[model samples]
Target: MKRIAIVLAAMLVTAAVPVGAVTAQQSSAESSAYAGTHVSFDASENAVTNYTVDGETVLQSVSTSSQANAGIGLDIALSAVTDIDASALSLGTTTETSATVQADSGATLNAHDNPKGTLVIAAGDESQYVTANLSGESKAEQVDDSRVVVENDNRTGTFIVVGDGEVTVNEEGNVSADLAEDSRLVFRSYDGERTAEDERSEELIANGSAAAEVYVMQENGSTVADTVTYDEQTTVETTSDAKDNVTMTIDRSVHEGTIVMTTVSEEALAATDNLSVTVDGEAAVEAESYSELQSAANGGDNSAYLVQETSADAESNVYVAVNHFSEREVSMTNDDSSTTDSTTADDETTSSSTNAPGFGIGVSVVALAGAALFARRRA
Candidate 1:
């Protein structure tokens, strides 16, 4: 049986309730910095929430299946001949939400076409993923460690995170969607990570020009003490004790902002050999199995994995399993008659402080053990 952690932070957000359409718009005083630009846009959503600048719709009704989508919307639009810029932009929704943005330049360059809004997803039993798309130049600051303040200087866009899911901010300078408590937010820009002052002080993973920053918040919306590890490599000795058995290696890495889990076996088997693997309790097949898990463990990806390999001779069978998570605290247990196993994380740890940016999305390590059991059949 799966145990649901009773997180206090997860309880604070008011569950979404049915509500009527709400909208708000704001205009700025003419600025010498942004010359030859006129602000114009039209933005509306379900039930008719709208924001317009100079007769153009920028933010529109965001379409999603989550009930948390019902709320107020704000839209701002601006135009320019050569370029557009702004120092500060602020708007509010009827829900009394006042989102503000301040940028060094080009803040309103694409206000009419940029995507903006909030989307909330509740935690669930299956694997899922979501992205927060914010356009223009924007910055997100964690104010009072309760909620993230994301503002864009240029375009109108929507952003959100639901329940205990993870949100990845892949681009630099654009704001990521706001995540409620009990969620994880991953950043890919080196600039954002610099502002975050990663607590573990782990060297930034080089992604050519790509940058990243990670955030993991508790149910109360406060930052938690967690480490983001990447490219972690571990090996499990499954048949060493059986006088003859195969070896398994588990390599964890990130690609295009997603967790790529690849498993390789030492036993060189013919095409007829039988090998089976299970990730997070889901069955996988063959000598090599590659699967992608969520970047954050708040979802189901951070769980146990089991691998079994049998040779053509059928002399012995080997089994291996690992449980993964992203917290400092860890627990492990296993009860099987056969198999050899060991697990350790080479990832570094940073101090968790609210004073520094300390924002980056990373995964956790959970319980894991090695034992050999008769291949139990699932009835």
Candidate 2:
């Protein structure tokens, strides 16, 4: 179901982008200091880092190394911008633990809210062993055509979209990749300077872990359109078999929209047990579609939703997982659109504003175990 939705979103984006549209290829910043001029993967390998901005070599690599930590771990550089209107911006990682790219003096990486402005964080190459750990940030008019593609090593990566324009990941060229353990991909849109380390707002957590108490946040407004929380209980045949049991806690609050936790075991499968769910304290039933989760919101503040699952089998090894998650619907209006909106939860009303350009559409797929997954798309 998640794949189907993503395919449909891709189709919509392919149709929306006009032919011969200008892609984000420029790297110009009026304020020379704000313009990204150089990038490094790590401080130790700075001399060997290779980077370019607008066809100019800001840094030259002295050695060609592919070691996991070879060269400057992760970095980028941009040439001085003579014209902001002709420039485009992208932020990603090759080997750096984290990086940032900014446009100062009210200059946006992309002109207006053009979807063509892209931000990408993907495997530097297609080789399975060529895993790269990268996290990046950039100031753009909007973030829609960007993507984060990973294959082997589960490295945490995040992308931030700043300004009145929101992020639409489903725009043309946006793609989703299956995430590995401990891997997090975030796409955020904010009005403030989130570049400060102390002001980070996104995170990924596992169930039963030390960080389980943490709650991931998104600045500006909540993008989580829906959420699901349930419990799965099964019996175990033997105490040892419990070691193989896998329990996943589904968090629909993060930017990619889903956080999964899986348990490993030293023992083999002992037995399987029947399972049932009680959504929001209701009777257990199969959800025909994710819309049911949205209905659970009750028209309140549905931005952040939580679902918990616990399982036990007759002989242990009881596995519980969610079947689906709904994407947040984006309300895009003309330039005159106002941010005067409210959501009521527990008889309490919360108001927010989003004076954005038109909306961008996209979808993100999150996997649990055995290929089971959930889907989230920006409305």
Candidate 3:
């Protein structure tokens, strides 16, 4: 039964893969190719602890489900030009939410579209993502702990992360995103942009030029082991033994801002210039043990502590942007079991930071581990 719960928990993200209206891409020579308001998007489901609804879609001049969609994890990625008015976004609830949004250049992410008085769209405990367009000479803004962006494509912008999450940016990933308290932000440009022309040699290749940039501002939270972990422990009465722990990775309830930026000049996937802004309240995790650890005596009673260590230590901003993504790969590695798991793990600590100019929309694998052990045996 416990194992069943773990499986369910892993799948709790109901992840509704948004089935976008499919359309083919146009040639670079086509002026209309990859035009206005193109922004990548994603959403998740049902776990909201609180909420609020708004006016009808077109009523507020926005798209409306008019209905309710169950299930949880919703992931929508727009690979082409869009006409979505960000302000027109009608969020059905304003309570506890965990949805996120991402976008590349050529895609208009007009933040001002969703005004409090205009429509009924607001999400709490959620995150946002955007890619800036350097050509349009515009910028994205957000205030969170995790953010990253680059302008190697030749654009300037600002981002703000006022949440408890962390932010990071790469080289050529130009940005003006800033970080706040417990939250962290990073900006580094070491790679060049990936251009569509570069992929001309490949019949199936889309955009070829690659850059890295991420822009984010975070507030706070803890992301740690949400599953089982068997670690070797040093014993005094015995030689050694495996220890179980209650662990999970958590981040500020407010996960806001963009994570990828590309240039529209190359391929639809390579656009930059995303503006975002977010302010989330403090969030915390109640240390819990994974069902798998039941094999240990009194394992259920053990508390947890976050074991964090960075190259720059003591929780400072660390940027890893690259003009040439082909050059670097800065990230976190963990125990074999955790590190080998998935992208969520590789990003034990994450920010809105992203790959520069190319804005490849790299995914972050965050897994914050909260570990704690008591010096007592099962009674």
Q: List model 1 lDDT by residue over 38-98, tens digit each.
A: 2222222211113322233323211111213312122311101111111222222211111
Q: Which 10 residues in a row give candidate 1 its minimum summed lDDT? A: 363-372
Residue-level lDDT tens digits of model 2 in 1-379: 7666667566655645633342322222221212221222211221212222222222221111122222222231111111111112223222111133321111111111101111222222211001112122221222232223211122222342221111222222222222222222233222223333212122221111111111111212321111111111111111111222222233343222221211211122222222333323333333333344333333322322223222312222111222223322211111221232333111111223323234332221112211232234322
After superposing all C-alphas onto the true structure, candidate 2 shows an RMSD in angstroms of 24.4
Selected candidate, larger TM-score, 1 vs 3:
1
lDDT of 3 by residue, 1-379 (tens): 4554444445333222221211122222332111111111212121111111122111111121111121112343221212222222211211111122212111111121111111112122223222222222323332233333323233222222323332333233222221122221211111233133211111111111111111111113312110100011100010001111011111212212111111111101111112111112111112122121121112222211112122211221111111111112222111232223343323222323212233211211111111111111111
After superposition of all CA atoms, the RMSD between model 3 and the true structure is: 26.4
| lDDT values, one for every candidate | 0.24, 0.23, 0.19
Ranking by TM-score: 2, 1, 3
The reply for model 2, stretches above 4 Å from the true place, is 1-273, 279-284, 297-379
Q: List CA RMSD, all candidates.
A: 24.6, 24.4, 26.4
Q: lDDT of model 2 at residue 78?
A: 10
